[model samples]
Target: MSSLTKNLDAIRQNNKIGHFRYTIGVTLFGMQLINYFDRVNLSTAGPSMMSYFHMSSTEFGIVSSAFTWTYMIMQIPSGLILDKIGVKWVSRVSSALWAIPTFLTAFVSGLGPLILLRVLLGVVEAPNTPAGSKAAGYWFPLRERGLATALYDSGTKFANVIGVPVCAFLVLHYGWQSAFFFTAIMSVIFSLWYWIIYRNPRESSHLSKAELEYIEQGGAQEDAQPEPGVNLWFVLRQRKMWGLMLGNFAYNYATFMFLTWLPSFFVKTLNLDIQQSGFMTAIPWLFGFIAEIIVGGWFVDHLIKRGLDASKVRKTTIVIGLSMGIALVGAAYSPSVWIAVIWFTIALTGVCVSAAGFWAIPSIIAPTGLVGVVSSTMNVSGMIAAIITPIITGAAVDATGSFATAFILIGVVLVLGVFGILVLMGPIEQMHPERNDSNATISR
Candidate 1:
């Protein structure tokens, strides 16, 4: 039998001979889980810090946004670095560097130091999502891209589900500083693990020849470096890229709003204590984690495997998922805590489903040699929203004395995201950076 046929047979027979791509996916997922654990520590500790520092919600918002300001500025550069140096090296260095800020966060005695560390944290961790996207591009075939992307992107949801409660528990018992120390240890360990374990398909002795052939034949970008001249400036000028930016910006606005403010909302709006809020906050993200894995990852891939048009399937998934974000409005008006959790759960589940598809887009659409650049460009938009969301939500809550206005604003932005996806991102196809607006449709 042919190697591809034999590999397919091995997979069908449940022989674990050719599935190392998923190992890569799981590694990326672990990285993101740790990355977000670090990110969510501040949110879990926000109330205590606000009390200790004697800061208003507005000032606290600025502190929370400090991470994204540098994160957003570094996105393009992060992408360039990843593209220039390659994923394994850039990721290795970033993973080690991020631990420093996370560790120092425990020692900050004043707001200035806290903000400076947050900015540094942002600077170091900026390569994370783009690197995951690039790694997925290199490892998985076009057909399996959704699941691979979701595997990692879903880490954000899973982290929120568990990280909030864990951080809160640490904050409640061992003090807020304990949470930072815990995450810093996790980061250091993961940095070492990743450095030792990760290798591209070509370099990996553990990967089977059969699997390598399967991936390459199935459209994995094994070693497709960016063509000599496809720069970030070249990527920025595309209309499709703009659509991606706008859509991702809207998605991330809701994401950051939830990450930064959800616990505060539970305490301030629902009248729950920090411990109760931590557990309650986990419900929505728990549902999000499940939906991202089952719906975004598996179901989308299943549909494509059944011979559905890849573009229509992805577009429909994104639109329907983002449309469900309007449920945030329901949470805003909820009369009881459980009711609010239910609404938020629905909203988050939808957002998570769309994330799988969104993360897959850069790999699917970027011209030869520009996957890293395109992914980072898209992330820049999301980080911009991340910077803005906390500040806007915080100001709204302070001005209105409630979270209702902030929730409504997020719903409106979600709607605009749908429009950007439908109207601006015409077709999910690869573009030629050398040619003016030339798109080559790929057959699934």
Candidate 2:
């Protein structure tokens, strides 16, 4: 009886330290990735869809922009709604809503219905990043927050890595409609799993008291639960906020080019077959996913654990990443397709490294009280890039008869973002509405 009691006690202790929060974090990561798979699958399938509808490059651009328009419109509202209602409901509902439209896209034959369904999908999925950020905050302590944020936030690119190819394969083998069903079925299944498994530390039956106290004591705000009084106007006034917005737009302009146009570029520019384009397209994003997870999240976490100042750590990642992304121009000039893929892979790796830093910053800078509101505002700029880049690139391609000019232009935009960060951006620190915001960083 004594031995059995000791064995039982040891088992309970092991369970407590298993850090189930990491499990929840990774689940959100997977969910956000699946969200983006549904998003960018259209890019991979654009040729088939456009040919089927007898649409030009310009009209396809409109269809691509369809999701982003409503997605942009809903960012602010969705973030606040997630803050109020909590992650569980926001995530599950958003999944169902978007998944339904994704499913319906399979049945739509006309351009009008396709555009409308895309719009609805965007609106419903707008809560994705915001909810993932808030959920990261709830589950992770400060020390773990950066990596956790990066892990979930990198889902977009990570989706491109795996999701694009898989989606492309489905589109080819089973048809474009199958790509839609592939994502929808995955969404429904994951949302159900998330709804059943996820809960806050305080509310969770799986989390132990000792672990809960550890998180709450380590910069996790217990009082940040659903409440009121987030001031968006104040968020808009901060100089750093504007810089983030501008920087987001600039860098994402470059990034969105890949999301919306890369596969098409491969097929049209390099004369690859659909199968070759699908897998080749994933190559750069694969490098991106590796860099983001290893360098942005894991390396930064290692540095902080070694006693480096967190603000410097975050800023260093951002600047270096942006600088490296200038290589995108080289991709255009590469003499061959393989060489171009190498350049793009390098450029995207840089983007991923910096993106991990970018998403983590809002959590650190936003008043703990207003993370959702402020994050929504900053993230809007990224969606604006989504709205702009595809249409502009499509026009540029048609006008120039090649992607050369568009590639150089995208690199210039990313360089402008680098300048924005160096010139207009400030240190990574928590903001205070009551005082001067200029000198926000602390040496620690």
Root-mean-square deviation per candidate: 3.4, 5.6
Displacement of the residue 14 alpha carbon in candidate 2, Å: 12
Q: What is the lDDT of residue 320 in candidate 2?
A: 87
Clashes found in each candidate (C-alpha, N, C closer than 3 A)? 1, 0
- In order of appearance, the predictions have TM-scores of 0.95, 0.92
In model 1, where is the ten-residue run with the lowest total lDDT?
A: 435-444
Candidate 2, clashing residue pairs? none
Residues 288-387 of candidate 2: C-alpha lDDT, one tens digit per residue:
9888888999899778766688878887788788778878788776788999899889888898898888887776777765677767887799889989
Expressed as tens digits, the lDDT of each residue in 362-384 for candidate 1 is: 99988777788899999988999
Show where candidate 2 strays beyond 4 Å: 1-16, 223-230, 437-444
- Output the lDDT of residue 333, model 2: 68
